[model samples]
Target: MKLSFLVLAGAQLGGVLGLWPQPRSLQTGSSVLKLAPTFDIHVNVAHAPSDLEDAVSRTKGFLRNDKLGRLIVGRGASDSAAIQHARSLNTLQLSLVHGSVVKSITDEARLPLGTRSEEYTLYVPADGSSATITANSTLGLLRGLTTFEQLWYEYGGQVYTVEAPISITDSPAYPYRGLMLDTSRNFFPVSDIKRTLDAMSWVKMSEFHWHVTDSQSFPLRGARP
Candidate 1:
């Protein structure tokens, strides 16, 4: 069984940016900041967790457009889970600091049954001086990160920008969220499965039930003794 889960928090923005799955509480912003080729992201912490570091690394690549080189994350903090305090110096720089890091993304999935922690809060100041995202686990962080990415848009056919002065605090309304996919009746390739997973993540859906085998066919490859 392939099971995935997601919980949404509330969101508030300063302006109307119309986000998917609509954050529980969102306040849209007025100003918009363009993502220029020179835009850079810097992760600042004392001892960073591997997972947080990895997230930042991936974020660098995801934010990359055109020939913009890969971004680098600075080092700080060591705790697996800690609150981060950061400030952006200018429009060209973005800073992030977390209180603690989650060692693995799967860690949230391992919580005891009925766990309701997949929540996160994000703040993008109107001044654009800095942005902040806070969560109890990396799962929420990931969700917030996805939301942050969704905020960016391509303008003039080449530039990307996000509405400024946005704030969102999101959490799931239900304790258990899941999606079911039957692979037995209709074959789905690995890429398709991944796409489904991505879509689920975007909507903060937590559960992914993969029906790999059914009465129609049993194609699952079991471990050989």
Candidate 2:
């Protein structure tokens, strides 16, 4: 009787401890599973510089993260002294903002800039797959990354996967980017100007002209605010 009582207690403990075999369907239903996409990036660079090692390393970190998409950087002219210098600095900045590797460095890149057309000519990869980013300024390139970030964040924590190729042909028609500021017509806030400048940087636009006339004195008090 005592042995039987001990066996009963052991069985009860086993059941309480979940040692009893569970049905396959029940166990399967409790299992957690996830699906993720893969990425393949390509980069094209027109120049390369000596100080690009650290930048490239950090960029590789960004590319390898699952949240961010794949990236590839190709160099066009790594040997050119002038181009190399420019790329060294720009590549560093690009890596900090966008994780793109400088893959191929070459010296035979020619960008077209014309005065008549309003359209901007942006050199992008063919093939109709993968995101193509082209920028004349490091700041503009950073802005592109910000734009991508915004889009990705909007879609929750899902990774951005793209297989479609992009063919971008862009160029600015205006020789000088212009800004019209009218402090006279209406009271303008300083914060507004700062925000506008931030937006302007995204497009690689420089403020060539500012028309801030303080003629209409509605209430000028803050000493050239």
TM-score winner: 1
Please, what are the lDDT tens digits per residue for candidate 1 over residues 1-225? 223222222232224443666788887654545443445545443344576567656555655542321122322122112112112223322222344544355777667657746687887675546567777666667777767766654323233333466778888777667899998899889999999997887667878888888787998898999
Query: Model 2, range 84-125, lDDT digits (tens) per residue?
Result: 222110111232113533332111111232322223112212
State the local distance difference test value for candidate 1. Answer: 0.58
Q: Please give the RMSD of candidate 1 to the true structure.
A: 12.2
lDDT of model 2 at position 41: 27
Model 1, runs deviating above 4 Å:
1-18, 44-47, 65-103, 157-162
lDDT of 2 at 14: 30
